[model samples]
Target: MVFIRATQSSSDIACIAVAPLSIQPFGVEPTDFDAFWTQQKQTLAQIPINPRLTLLNTLPSGAKVFLLELDNIDNRKVYAYLSVPAGTGPFPAVISLPAFGDAPVQPEPLIMTDFAERCNSINLYISAHNAPPNLPDPNAYKPDDLSKKDGFYARTMIMAGIRAIDYLSTRPDFNGSLGVSGMSQGGGWTIQLAGLDKRISAAMPINPAFCEQDGWRFERASGFPNYVLVGRNLNVDSNKTLTNMRYYDAVHFMKRYRGALMFQVGYEDDVTPAATQLAAYNKYRGNSTLLTMRERGHTYPFDEYFLGRYAFFEQHLIGFKNPFNFKAKFLADAGNDRTVKDTAVLEPQFLVNNEKNKVSNIQWAKIEGTGNVGFQTENGKTVARFSQKGKYLLRVSADFDYKLADPSVASYYTLTDFVTLDVGESSNIDVCDSDKEAPNFSNCPQNIALTTMGTSALANWTPPTVADNCGTPSVSSNFLPSQSFPIGATKVIYRATDSKQNTAECSFSVIVTKGDSSTPPSKNDLAISLTSVVTTPRPHSFTTFKVKINNKSARTFTDIKIQIPFPSGIVTGGAATSTLGEWKEWCSNNDQCFTWLIPQLLKNDEAIL
Candidate 1:
């Protein structure tokens, strides 16, 4: 549940009730799921696996890097960068998938080098869709008619992964063990590929997308490719869309996957909600582990998360002991099952129980709100008091003294708690107008006093200043003072602003009557004239024009607006360059016009445009 309240100050305050993770099945395996995939693999097999390899400059003197391509189900081609160790009869392999969107999937020479020399494994980083391996082109591939089962891009992309595995099998240095890993859309593909292929030995999917298709129906976050279920992308045939999507849903795929699975989830991820990820994870009937990052939204800390993956794969693929075993606990007075008042005192604590590692450092952060509460460790207890009202995520991160076996051994753990603080009614403000009188052509009241109630309320005017036939007038303060006005009436508005940026306003009109000979004129006494510089002006041809404006009034004027219209078919070139004013172009009804705002024009003053 979420509640939003509009205040008299800044933006509305929001409080969200974090939902508990539970498996609510919304996907049903298609009746022809196995049959469809069986036919897909057969179709891919018929197309000769015309594998093409282009060797690039080898790095580190111990590995060879090559660009690999293979034909998939469609006429499209799949590309990847394959790095193989120097001396190897048959080496273990891992297939890295690309993320969603138009991000380039270039070969990472450093990453491939580490995988080949350090891990003693062949690494193949594959690109999804018909995307080129070296550069990203947003218009490379457009999804087909999603209403039909065979028209979707997921079908072809999934086939590409299957065909990649087939190409890896043909490698002279390929070992029997295989693994898949990716994040977001790539994560979804990893799980789907593992489920479809029984040869997969291990899988790690980080914040995977394209799961729980029906999540939007319950107001929960849906994965990428969720567009097919709502808005303009929604299929005309809802029933067929639902059935076809289930065939590609990750939850259905996880149910059949038997490989060792490790999943990473971010609790604050609106892209693929933790609930949806949990739904898929709970459905898996295999050996699996989940790493939850409480405050992360749509992404994970790459260094720590990848270290854990390296340890997992090292143990399973290389037959290593995986010595990295770090554990941490973060606790707060505000538990998951309860909500405290806005002014409640929060007591946070961090504990680490690792005999092999010592706690090196600790840090805390308030993810939301305008409170001045700062974390402090007093007597071995981490505590802070929150005084503001809003939603906040309190996070505590701890680093261990011991490092992992990978490039960086310093292992870290982070924990977070969601909190909401509700305060009383917001600050408010009120404003009133001041009455005044002034002789024609003479200055009126310059300032007015305002009556306001609330915290940090300020007075101001909407227009700030006004102009009439008599002269331009402005207020000195929040209260409107007597100012020069024309014979007619002029409206003056006064406003009040509160600390929270809330505003209230009131307006009054000033009327000026005819006066003696000493009184000023009631209208702006100015003359403007325009002339074409060219003697013969032709249609659709460019021509220069000269404009002159002069002020003949007794009083000075500022911020004067001058407008000039041009005939159609005569486009403007270059700039109208003004001698003493700012020029701006205006258009209406196929006609072009130019306006100049003269900053100041004293009596008998002239400006050229």
Candidate 2:
């Protein structure tokens, strides 16, 4: 298996440049490449997008972040971190994709940033796979059919990105100024999406992948997924790979991309070869800027490129304001996943990233782990102790403080990441202990009815009673008493998180319906809103749904009943737990439905079913 290798220097690579060409692909594009993608787009248009959004957290800059799920190809769904900026109106948007693994591997790129608030844009962050956010995923990066071009994962991945753009364009809050960005595989997608969708006004791809995929044919190192030699069988002869890898290569898609593009090239990048990235850059015939960072490698472009990824859109007049006045860098290290012996005491060393100069605080959170586990600081070093033997995922996050370029914008931002480890057997010392319970809001507020003649009304309600097992849990709400609620139904979500990062949430709605102040309302004036429900998407999986009922009148009602008919072909499952009423399941001539009956509906009070 060993053979003599011929060493080549930078000059050797420089001399092997291809013939003079612009808007050229790494290899010949399939004759039906354009037609095939057009047909895919047509198919995507027919599928309905069932969107479900659940509020996760809120940034100090008044941005509401949520986990958004949308149905995609083959009954699959795409999950993303959706950030809605403060103060409503149409706003420009940016969709940031991910590289290699399902989610962001490192702490910095694990979640999202404050670009939505600082730049006043709607931001959507997606992983390489359609997995949930903030959790360790082992099912990611599964094998795909590489024998055929159309059967490859690249087709669906690119189409999913296009569908993301389609979702943004249809949003009433989107101002139509759209941009796509990513590093590595995500970078490759950034270019491909821009090429496929005309809605993309700009793109920022950092050390992009899938570039010059056929460079191996010329005895050169290609980008990621480089199929140079199949294992040890060097004698196996094969020159064709599903249309010469033309249909799925980003270099081929570059010829069709005509937009404002600013891509970065890291001279030290080995994952995605620098030569292939340069070759793709040369082939793009449209307006593009290549920012070379000699010190960086395969990483997020925010640090390596000029200013940051968001700054490029601002510089190019893409409708976003630059929020950078100085450079803010954080290098979080949770160490790598490694197997530990019997004791399982000397866990992965979690180091603070750039703490001396810019960081204001350092924190650790346990994302997920089996058995019992806790993290403690020993001799100024972060360590984890497990009570049982198993593999676990951990995270170390640092608060980086920096001055924003815009004085009016937020002064700082936040980003998170992860680390993993495997333990043989625990020593059973069990020194470090953490609170495992979340604060409860047993007396959660009831939905209220507010009558307003104007566009908005000052709605008032009592704060929910919170009880915590471990000290006092920090509680926050998206809506406060006497806060202005727009004319319509609005959900008031309150969250309580403990010191151990355990959290609980309870939400109710405020229904504001316009009515004549002089006229008395009718017998029934109610507004009902349903909270988002998340399911496994697997067939026959158990699911749960929460529905809130608000009485939008001053008059009390008695003997009220609500009926919900189940969709056709959905086999009924036992479900019923009422907070203020009784639920009855009845079938009328083969059709199934649920009926809830309330003896008394109090004025301005809400019922849950």
Candidate 3:
């Protein structure tokens, strides 16, 4: 619950923490924590793993790559990219977890080619969610609701990690030196897996999220998936939510973890704040080392620090000598210029002093802005100009090629510089006047210019900031009419968000007169009834359904579409008939479903399918 901020003499060096590590546990350890997990594992053990492996031959690497899939709890499947070094004997194994977003997991051969070849081990990069890796939308597998105790998202994700280990144990080349590594949510999973599975030998979690759930209560930033605390404007039962969260808290797991742990923490990380990480680190009872970076935030430095992690695994898992001697310094050309105009040019420089290391690649040199600011090389040095006015952080990372004994590993390091661009002040906007008896919805004004003084002035408004049943109002520089609103006074909220993520919001009321307009109809005014009556009682028998759609509203409905989902076992022979509508049947993942579309339904009209 205590924080100490340590100032650094150089911007390259992060501000370190002066506070002593304290074991300030947040949530109470559930009384049935052990029993609950035991039951979970036993339940998972009962399911048959209809495992499947497909070799990927296009990506040529030192190791053989295969796409592996196995069934987990909840009928969800685990998809991972497995890489095994070409060898018959057993090898050390490592499981890499993913971060906390919808970011795609690159193909195994493309991402882990270097690490697998260097470690000469089996690497399994599993999807954080139930869906396949590199999915266009990773949130597709996200649970519908997290408040439910029995089927929480984190529980399934944690079990996937455990089940991944179970799958690894069954492999013929399993050497048993299992280690888990990941950043953010992945880091939290590493802790959860290492604690739950005794077979795990080591774990390295970087800026792990989902720890210290009570930090926000003490006025500190909470970790990712900040579930315990309700939203800024939300109503929920906090006591019940907190009770369910304690079951999966990483700090509680850290207390029971018995594996070798190398935890990396960023002193300036707002996502997984240092205070929260320390809370878990201080309580760890196993052999552990805390690697602290002063200048880093939510991201890993990826330089010598990351190399140290690889070395940790190499030493413990494969008996390789630790290549711990590596150093690099990041320099900025702006010097002490903390604030600059958006037109100013900034160039970053890298200083590598270690003789044993070589900069193999310059990954990127870019600024963190709302939009892309094009980069160009000037004077043989990488330079970027700020396009939009806002605060920006210029980040640079490079891969350092080095060797430790027989294995050659590439260590990536990153350096960042913070700067603010003055784009000028945001302009306040006034709501345009509308007639009280205007037919249909009034057109919210458009092209309301923002301050042009800065680099770029862009405007956006929060959706549903003001609730009007006339569909959500749309706003850009100008307001546009959405759906027709009922005759009433409704407030519309608008805001301008700058490149720096700064915002200015304003609200105005629009009064609609009750001249010729009736009250807006609710979306739930339509009623649907589907009754399935079996024509034959035996298996593979024909089934008939009585479907009815009734418009229980005074307003006419247009473009009415209804989708009916059926179980996988149901074999759709085809739609029998439809009255005043068109019906179509489709199959998704071999599951039959039906959709009906009605062009228009008059008030109080009914249609049967």
Judged by TM-score, which candidate is best?
1
Go through the candidates in order and give each one's C-alpha lDDT. 0.62, 0.65, 0.61
Clashes of 2: 3
Comparison by lDDT, 2 against 3, better one: 2
- Candidate ranking (lDDT, best to worst): 2, 1, 3
- Clash-forming residue pairs, model 2: 107-416, 107-417, 325-405
Off by over 4 Å in 2: 1-26, 103-111, 136-138, 227-244, 294-296, 300-302, 326-609
Clash count in backbone of candidate 1 = 15
Give model 2's TM-score versus the native structure. Answer: 0.48
Off by over 4 Å in 1: 1-21, 138-141, 229-231, 319-609
Candidate 3: clashing residue pairs, number: 9
> Quick one: best lDDT, which candidate?
2
Can you write out model 3's per-residue Cα lDDT over 511-556, one digit (the tens) per residue? 4332212433466778889876754558867767878888887555
Per-residue lDDT for 1-609 in model 2, tens only?
011222321122112222211213346677898898898888888887778888877777888887878877756667788888888757888888877775443323323456666788888887556577566567564434455555566777787887777788788988898888888888888878877898888888888988877776766667886644431133323454635466777876776776777767765566887677776765554444445544445664344344666456775435576677633333334455688743333322222223342443344544466755554442224556677777776554444434334333222332233456677878765433445767788778888776654566666667887756544689998989867777799999999987778889989998877756565445467877665355444686655666778887785444567887767866664766776669877645544777788665557788888
TM-scores, in order shown?
0.52, 0.48, 0.51
